[model samples]
Target chain A: MISPVKVWRNQKKIQKILGLYGIIVSWTKVHVPPVGFSSQAPYVIVVVKLESGKSYIAQLVDWSENSLKTGQKVKAVLRRTKNPGEEGVIPYGVKFKPV
Target chain B: MKISVLGAATTKFGELWSRSPRDLVMEAVNEALDDSKEISLQDIEAVYVGNMLSGTLGGQDHLGAFFAEELGLHVPAMKVEGACASGGLAIHAGVTAVSSGIYENVLVVGIEKMTDFKPEEVAEALMGAGSDPERDAGASFPSLYALMARVHMEKYGTTEEDMAAVAVKNHYHASLNSHAQFTFPVTMEKVMESPVVSSPLKLLDCSPISDGAAAVILSSKIKKTGRNIFIVGSAVATDSLGLAERDDLTTIYAAKEAARKAYKMSGVGPNEIDVAEVHDCFTIAEIIAMEDLGFFGKGEAARAVRLGQTRLGGRPVINTSGGLKACGHPVGATGVKQVVEIYRQLKGIAGKKQVKGAKLGLTHNVGGSGATAVVNILKG
Candidate 1:
């Protein structure tokens, strides 16, 4: 029997803020895989508060020693993460880079 | 009907390679049974078991019944899950049962077997406490707290050095605790230089995962025992499960509200608390909790620690059992183990780390990034 598939309303329209200026709220240098997830060690994981008055959790790209601070200004870029499943199908998400 | 702790026991908390969850539970149960022989197995009318991630890590659920049957008991039993506050919640249930006249004797057990899985898998299971988007994006549990630590640093001028100091203090206390997982005294320099798990939070700042269990019996037949530890206050509160949804990220509303309710119920203010066992899953968490519990003003917990106000003989002697950071967090068993410490301290059998004249004690257990907070007060 076929059942009607439901789709997300997307009513809370998330405004993707690429190249938007944001400040770091909190961050961690992820050194190991979390659960079933894998990660390249020492990657800077951050929570960025966008100028739009919204906050997001993201990974930092182009990171450098002493580059990321609590109030450092950063810009978000659409980036790709490793494939969630297989077949090299990767998903694009926002990642902050020091501006 | 009043509720009081009839007996309490905890396994030596640490990485137990030789034990399973069931074995740890039996160990704690037998100890509790021996500690207070007044309440026997048949006297236990029902059981409330607390556990988190057992289904994922131990591949088991229906734990309350499993535990009851494992112990050869014939009574209603069930599991309670409130992230890291599971043990606190279980005791709350037991207290309610005994206080409401529904049962004369109630049993509460909190257990977790974290070492059954490999390190990364354990990290994955711990992510169950985080926001869906955050966890899906690969934010580990420590990262969630690191974010909080960052905001705290930005808002209050708190330093990484202050965060390192918490580890130093807890390790000193843990050195006195035989059941502590990490009994060695850690220095501030070592904590600061330790490999960073999350930027301001080092590996030493976080709690170690271990296998352990704790149990307590709550009874209304308090007159039979010449001495007693009364459950004076019990309260639990909740907040937005996801941090993004909260109006304020700097403060945990659940803890604030729960502490408020417990204090009100017990008619005991923060100044009156003699000793306390707070959930210190991370060093920043301890600071936040002390402030939320009204022990200090907002953003002042760090300074209070720096002043040596929270040491064993200091102000209220917080985390005399070394806290999760040193005592080891079995997750589910943490809350109950806290009560065991308070109980022992109140009975004057806490050995070396005993507060000089502690008469009032409090326990604050938090679940998942402040999503659930349980506060209980005891008076001797």
Candidate 2:
């Protein structure tokens, strides 16, 4: 299912695309759409490709974070653990770095 | 030091009624005893048992001592475990014991009782073998491999068709194996249409949960038949416990390390090997393993498989025993079973699955998600 973070990103992208089209139309198919059935598991895997030619599999901790959208660029930091008593830390999640 | 496998035996790969864990071990032991008439239990000074999930799968624990008691051997007995590679690791220990002067002869048996548990329960029990218990929360075995499938596809450009080809190849080979868990050949289309167990990993891509046993006898004294295959090299390695800890999810570090050591000790490159039986627990695993083991260049195993280069009569025959994917991965028994197939092929007795002029053979066994690996090279 599309995360709310993704929904907001889609709204922004669609607004820009509509502006380029030079027409204010009702909601288009490019707008944020409802996601289908998906599990509510606390942890989710997000694959991120960085500018350094490195990729990472990280866990999304902040489900409500608006910056956690598909196709958005973010930097990753390797960590020790995702939860208490976890065996080892990993690159838990990615966040948009301030320009 | 030269270590020779005198004989081997294995029960049919499937649900075996009227046979308890003791019965399975005894049956294979008796077969090995018969095969090794020149050397019997009187010559055997020790026994090593390879069993995984026996306590949860068969309601039996302390199997090492129990196996020796059933075989009526008073020798020192021990058990070794490495998830699915338990059998291969056990054989490595037996070979060491025989070659190290600790024993003239040693017995190594690999057995698993998978039918004892229901299917869903078996899946749960097997899932505990991977690193996902801590990360994915409760990801099943299929899901872990599915993730592997996804990552391999994303990184190496591996496709669903490529993964299905592994199953198709192994299934065809399994059809020729009388004792395989899956005895029917499958086509690429059939594999593609199989029900999805997890995204990208179909039911056909997964090995069956099976109950079976495989055993081998090792001897330091060379047999007069000149038929014995010498264990030229053997190596085992461990990888990071977590998949996320690896540099590349598409590569199995344990397999890469063990294959390197085995090749170094044997003084033979992958191209020099005549035949192989690699761990194909999942379709994606076999694809990644081919690159990791130096059988093919990175991202080239799929092309090699597509060209039929790994078939029985091809460049390097892999998984001629059907592999775990189609041959039934009786966890503990899988490693030994691979060795057994190699031994038979090297002896030119593998019948339909035999690779012509197979003087040198190799076997690769992986535990859970490449956590543990054992590779052996043999020459007749």
Number of the top candidate by DockQ?
Answer: 1
Question: Model 2: residues >4 Å from true position, as ranges?
Answer: A1-99, B132-136
What DockQ class does candidate 1 belong to?
A: medium
True-contact fraction for model 2? 0.01
Candidate 2 lDDT over residue span B166-241, tens digit each: 9999999999999898899999999999877666677888898888888898988888864877888899999866
The sequence of per-residue lDDT tens digits that candidate 2 reaches over residues A24-77 is: 000001011011102333333444444544343433334444543445444333
Q: Could you tell me which residue pairs clash in candidate 1?
A: A35-B124
What DockQ does each candidate score versus the true complex, computed on alpha carbons? Answer: 0.51, 0.05
Candidate 1 TM-score, true structure as reference: 0.92
Candidate with best TM-score: 1
Return the lDDT, model 1, position B318.
93
Residue pairs with colliding backbones in model 2 are A80-A89, A81-A89
Report lDDT per candidate: 0.85, 0.74
